[model samples]
Target chain A: MPLGLNSPQIVLLGVNHNTAPVEVRERLSLSGSNTPALRLFAELPSCEEVVFLSTCNRVEVLVSTNRLDEIRESITKLWLDRGKMDSNTLQGALYEYHGTSAIRHLFRVASSLDSMVVGEPQILGQLKDAYRMASEAKTAGLVLNRLLHKAFSVAKRIRTETRIASHAVSISYAAVELAKKIFGDLTGKNGMLIGAGEMAELAAQHLIAGGADKLVVANRTLSRAVELSRSLGGSAISLEEVGDALVDADIVISSTGAPGIILSKDQVKRIMRPRRHRLLFFIDIAVPRDIDPKVNDIDNVYLYDIDDLKGVIEFNKAEREKEASKADRMVEAEVIKFMAWMESLNVVPVIQHLQEKAEAVRQKEILRSHKVIESLNDEQQKAMDVLTRSIVQKILHDPIVYIKKGAQKKNSEMILDAACSLFGIDGLEDTQKLQDKCLSDANQDKTIRKPSPN
Target chain B: MHKFLFQITVFIYFVSTVGFLVHIITLRKDAERIATVVLSVGFGFHTAAVLMRWFVGGHPPLVNLHDSLSFLAWAMVGSFLLFQWRCKLKSLGAFVIPFAMIIMTASSFQSKEILPLPPVLKSIWLPIHAIICLFADAVFALAFCIAIMYLLQERQIKKKRLGAVFQRLPSLETLDAMNERCLTVGFPLLTLGIVTGSIWAEKAWGSYWSWDPKETWSLITWFIYAALFHQRLTVGWRGRKAAIMTIIGFAVLVFTFLGVSLLLSGAHSYATWLK
Candidate 1:
């Protein structure tokens, strides 16, 4: 992709859950290198502000800088170091979204509309945790804090006030449901789980393929299998007697740590003779090897390993995408809300600036004509002051009116920028400083205000 | 100054009340703002006229039927001003200012003789009681305005009209907050006023609970408003239910203020201000 010359003042450089893999991500986890990345981010002379959100799925560096080339260089160097990439390999596999798109992306990510799992609630909490940690580390400041908080509020409105989260089934729930469909009323069924994992425990629960006549937990370690069996209301069996277990078992799910196949073709063939090829279902779930591929060729045997689960997962993925379309609509509305908040921020400063400017003009003119104004005397001056203030207020009202109208359209930013530029709103520098100081300080003075009885 | 301001006050308030009706039903902004300004001007004129009456009459202006009606009208406007400060329901001036103006007109028609103050109303507590109750009523009236706005806004949202009025009107949540705030401030004030009035009534009538139309309707008013506040806080009341309840509460207050006084021929015998 060609990079535009008029790139945004700030650019984001990173991969998210949408890009990159777990193996590549785990190494670049921000926790390992820790303070150096943040220090470097701060130390870079061109980088005004920096925030890094490093989740298991993604590692990103958000920088505030008008200098694009310099920020890009620093970000690229950081990525290479984190990814342990060769210099030549920095060619592709990286992406950038600038300015509005970048901010919108942050909002979406914080709201979890862009998560690997659609409408998954955990991403929001994770993002918040990242933001909080950044704050405590003195890495995330006012801009990020405000952006994140506003994003959270937008998300909250979407979650509470919309049906965006309705009927969102978890992966575990889908897995169990699939199991029940395959088993078709699991009463008086004998099943053996070859490994004792959380998945097996969950599968053994009453929600899923339960009500087995006998449940066997076979593991390399007999104690572990025994413990798993006890927790899951089943019996323990050894990996050595795996063939014997397979003979009696109506269903077999094998997920064990084996350097090679524990149940080879020869073993299954012998078991077939003893068991008379009883209609058995075999599910091999281990990463390397648990059951032999040749064993699947036996007659009256149905086999579905991890690879077959992929097809089912793909179907689930498509369904999740359909649900995510609904979530996306919610996200779009939420983005508009957040934009409104940001626009309101833009309008507020301009309003305050206008008010202050008008007040200054009124005070200066009154003070300049103090002697001539004395004909009005004390009572008349007070009345005239009130009248003058009202006139000023009336005069000062129209732009705020327009600004409010423009607020709904997200045009407030352009309006504010133009106003600040046109009026030479240098006072805003002081205002910005004041805002930062307020944020940095502890908010100890909390008051619950109740109006006085009329 | 006294007679001139009084007539102008009554005229402007009456005109603004028409404006209020126009704005409330048609929901016109210019009419609303105009009504607010007109009623504000009327309030200014009323204050001037009432001040003159007190100064010229050499009394607290609660001395006779005429004086008391004038005082009641003054109290209503005063209460309206107090609420308008916080409530931001200046549109309500169209309804309330006319009510006040009509009371002033009624006072003008009453016998202008300066009768001696009844010993019952002579106590310092009577003014305080009257002031607090009237102000609480104003707050309730403001809540009624919020409730109306809430209903209108709710209707617009439900219909998805998204018009200018809908845009300007605060959200249902905001209106709910305003209604709650009004009740929060108004309730205790009403409580104090009722306590004071009851104490003064005990001294004069030799019984606190006389079941006079005024007293009975006042309790009814209190019960209705108290129920509104309770329903809102306790029952998680919002939107149409709260809005309808608020409207009903205001109707009860108006009935206590006007109906019990005129139609019912109670101890509170104020001649009908409306022609």
Candidate 2:
């Protein structure tokens, strides 16, 4: 008596990388704002089963909707309240999807196909957490339950089958990717980290992992320098000591938020004089860039900026793309299979009724035949009854085959109604009457478990 | 037949060189293809002309500098044609055909008349010196092409000019592999040529180490190439540094082939095209 998976209609509203900046995403961050939103959603008569996914690159609210217009408006108002602007203010930046499009969009988002980095796996987990929070608040229902479960399964299929999620996820990883392509491995090489900034720290960590020795971190502040030394397990040197440190530094990464060039062209030239022209890897990650752009003119010097790293980043992105395509194909296949299962759901009750009626017929026919066989003997009558039951089962087999075929090709409901009319069958009416109660009981506040092996 | 074929071969070479130079300045592949076709025509005629000279002169064409240079260049054209057939390496011939044409044209300036040699040139070393040196020189000429490509490719990569020509050029790793393969094959052949030349020197000059201008320059060219070979295998040298060194080696090769004959006075004066 499960209430047929009657979802309110599906609706999707979101802002993504192209429409919103980091600042906009930070303002609408779901970090501490879910409580009031959940209460408001429950208060809305038409809204049910909400899954809110909020990440740095995307902000989306997917919810069940019996009233599509009211839900789309309500979701847009939430954006308006957060931005303190008119609902139409975000019109240019916002995208809305309904029905099957909403389902497909959510599958894409949860699968990371829509991610800025594309193929990154965090969004799926974020999506799962969002669904879990909704279920806890008693917002999710039968349609939502099945949809979330399918979304998770589709995401899992995509990750396993596609190349989208096949690459490094962090800044340090991208840096290492670039270095590995440049010099296969940095074993036996000495590297210097300048300015203990966040970007420099990340690059240094990757270089050390790549088998390079962290010779020193040259910084302006000594106490902050000592912290970097203890943290990185490398020596700390004063900013004045950078020039002295240049000769032995094979790979120099600088990320100070300096106003101008920290390592000038003249200093690198002076350094070249003493080093007998050894190879130099100058990585600048400052906003204005720490190293001079002209330093690339030096022979044997390989200088790379954030923009230069973009090419390598794009390569990593391409790797993700290849994996994503595989994942997409996998998702497509699973979606087809899931759709088939959904269609099968349609005729399940009719098939169940047909099965019940067949059993009743076998039981009645066997009882009648037993009475007729009383003339034979006690053991012979039982044998005759068994033969009668077998015959009834065989007689019902062809109709059962046609019913199953009808379930697959035509609508299950249509096939079931036709079969009921033909057989003059009128049982299981109680099941149709108890749809809401069954749906509520079936959902019963249980979380849809994610369907991938840990 | 030999004379007429040689005229046709020289004509094709001249036209193809003009075609390539114009095409390169225009940045047109259509023009380049036309140039390549002309070069192929030249090669066919050049091959026939050499075979005819062999039939008419009654010996192999490697008897003297003039015939040896022409015949070797024809073999180089064959090598290039075979390379193009196997791989999409026609872009290479745009640089190479001009070189082959230069050698052929330079040989043309020298007499094509058959002349009997003195006792020194009359020895069995005549064919041995001509064949080994010329064929090995052809391989080195190919190596020279790869080296220049290596340098240009490196510059384009460093400058981040990823244009059609840049893309059309083989990958840096691929060019390095090709350069290494060519050097490896050419180096040993050159070594053999030097060894045979030393033996010939001993028989002709009564001393193998007299340091004739051509001999001295040949040894210098040999030393440069040997250094390049050693550095690549042992020192792991390649890319820009290796490319520059290769350019330097080619300069010395020019000096050995042209320098001793053109500017410096030497016993190998008969090998000069200036005569």
Candidate 3:
């Protein structure tokens, strides 16, 4: 259904990793609390409700307003002013969606379909935080409160219904996944870290999280090893002790800056006997590789350099994309449902006003004929009251049905206007207020009821 | 009646084998459960058939090639069921059930006639020697399947392919542990089987160390396993090496159990008994 002039419309404006380069996003990114941004948006003359969402990858403003163009222009100006950037530099970087598409975009963002790394979970949490900030600032009124909650539930639904977020898509996580495949469970397994690189440290942390019992950090600089080990709850050893440590370590991640191979096939082979040929996994994430490629040929020794981990990430990325298409369809279906809810909001006020007017007229006429009622018996007066109420309800039933049915059609605004004018109810302002109350009541009911997609 | 039950057992094994294969392809939990349940039912029928044969023939049903093959299938299923009860290795049946089905089918093809027990076979050591040896063979069969899975999974990790087979198979460490467990249990039983067979042979044929084809091959198989067991204990020959050795040992064991009887003329040959 097309929105009328007076009906509130949703508008989303943002610059994401896809639409802007890192430099541009960095300039536009709102890093901390979004309270100031929420207040600024709420103070826009035409904007009724707002939720400001900002993250490392995206900065977005979701707003409900009567005048979409005015709100869009003002928000864009305010965003550019906040980022201290001129309009010409960000002209091509900005993107906007309106009405139903805006709802769809919010859903996609909430579900991480719009993330730089699609299906990453942090965006949903960031969105929730932004929404909470807006709510605390009293900037997120009925429309935004309902919209953000719907977005969260949609994200939850997609997460459960599809395998979009189940696979590991990062280097360290891929290492953990492969480790699990080779070792089944990493519980009580020894892990050896042979470098102080960030990626290597992260991989070691993931191994520890995956239940590896102990970690040994061996680096050329004993001080760096000690520093890293202190944070990881692991022991630090000199580089000379790596050979001895290899015998005890079940999983080894080597990212040393050595120009040549640090662990060779012969060394691994000699240690295999001492290791009782237990399965040994090596993740060599360093450039110019720290472990020999032929080390994998040694029985029970598995070595994966950076390229292999990337290959795994690529495979998992493809798998996630396949699941993402399924999630997209779910989001599309939900957007339609929310749009229908918005459409029903249009007719709710008119229907309420028509019924209220009929009841008021009935009560006024009853009061006007009080003398005749006083002349009648109490039982007759009771029948007179029931008869008048039933007549009013019967009279309004067909019109209410007509208005609800019309709301689902393309000419809903026209039908609504005709119903309002014919009833002599100049109720546009009253309609807005009534719709807000109705939506708030619906929101309360939503919290108390089971969360169904419908 | 026993012949009919054996036929039913074979049919049920074929069905369960299909179920397990489907489970491997689809990776459906219900398929695995149904396959396990159906295999248990088939094992029940197989046990009944073997017991019925023992009662009717007045022997332990270890006389001819037909009875031996059927009994081997029964032993394999029993051991597999025992393992299934203890472990969570559900995909194992995909590799194992087909082997049992093939043996059952082979047993069905052989003559089902119940011959009178030969005088040489009429001894108290018959059941003990045959049952222990067949049970050891069953355990070795389990190791063989587990070894194959280990190689497949190890190949995926080393090659870094990580395909569908990689996803379905258990971890290399778990498979190797299962392989080691099989060896630990199967080796002692094999040693005891050989000892008991030697005793029975001396009592029956007046010789314990015959150069018969079956006896010689069994000795060779025993030596291979003994070496593997020794190295595994002392030097830690595990994972790929252990997996390969388990496979090789099973091959030799199979030849001693089957090829010696079918191809080579020996005291243990069913051909001699049939004559």
DockQ of each: 0.01, 0.06, 0.66
Q: What's the residue-level lDDT of A235 in candidate 1?
A: 88
Q: List the residue pairs that clash in candidate 1.
A: none
In model 2, how large is the Cα lDDT of residue B21?
A: 75
Supply the global lDDT for candidate 2.
0.71
lDDT tens per residue, model 3, B138-239: 999999999999999999999999867887999888898899899999999999998998999899889897888888998999999999999989988888
Stretches off by above 4 angstroms in model 3 are A1-10, A26-35, A45-49, A64-74, A77-91, A98-100, A138-150, A153-169, A261-265, A329-454, B1-85, B101-134, B191-216, B265-275
- Docking quality of model 2: it rates as incorrect
TM-score, B chain alone, candidates in order: 0.75, 0.85, 0.97
After superposition on all CA atoms, how large is the RMSD of candidate 1? 24.6
Docking class of 3: medium
Model 2 chain A worst lDDT window (10 residues) = A445-454
Better of 1 and 2 by DockQ: 2
Per-prediction backbone clash count? 0, 10, 0
Question: Which should have the higher TM-score, number 1 or number 2?
Answer: 2
Interface RMSD of each: 27.2, 5.6, 1.0
- Order candidates by TM-score, high to low: 3, 2, 1
| lDDT per residue as tens, model 1, A1-454 | 1111111233466665545556555645545675656665667776766777777766667765646547677767766676577655343445565544556667667766677665567777877776776677676655566767777876676566443453225433443333433344456667788877676565556432455678888987899999988877788988777778777886677777677777877777777656643445666667775788777665445456665555455555555566555656766666556545543544565666667878988999899989878877789899989988999989767866876677567454466555656656665644444443332221221111211211
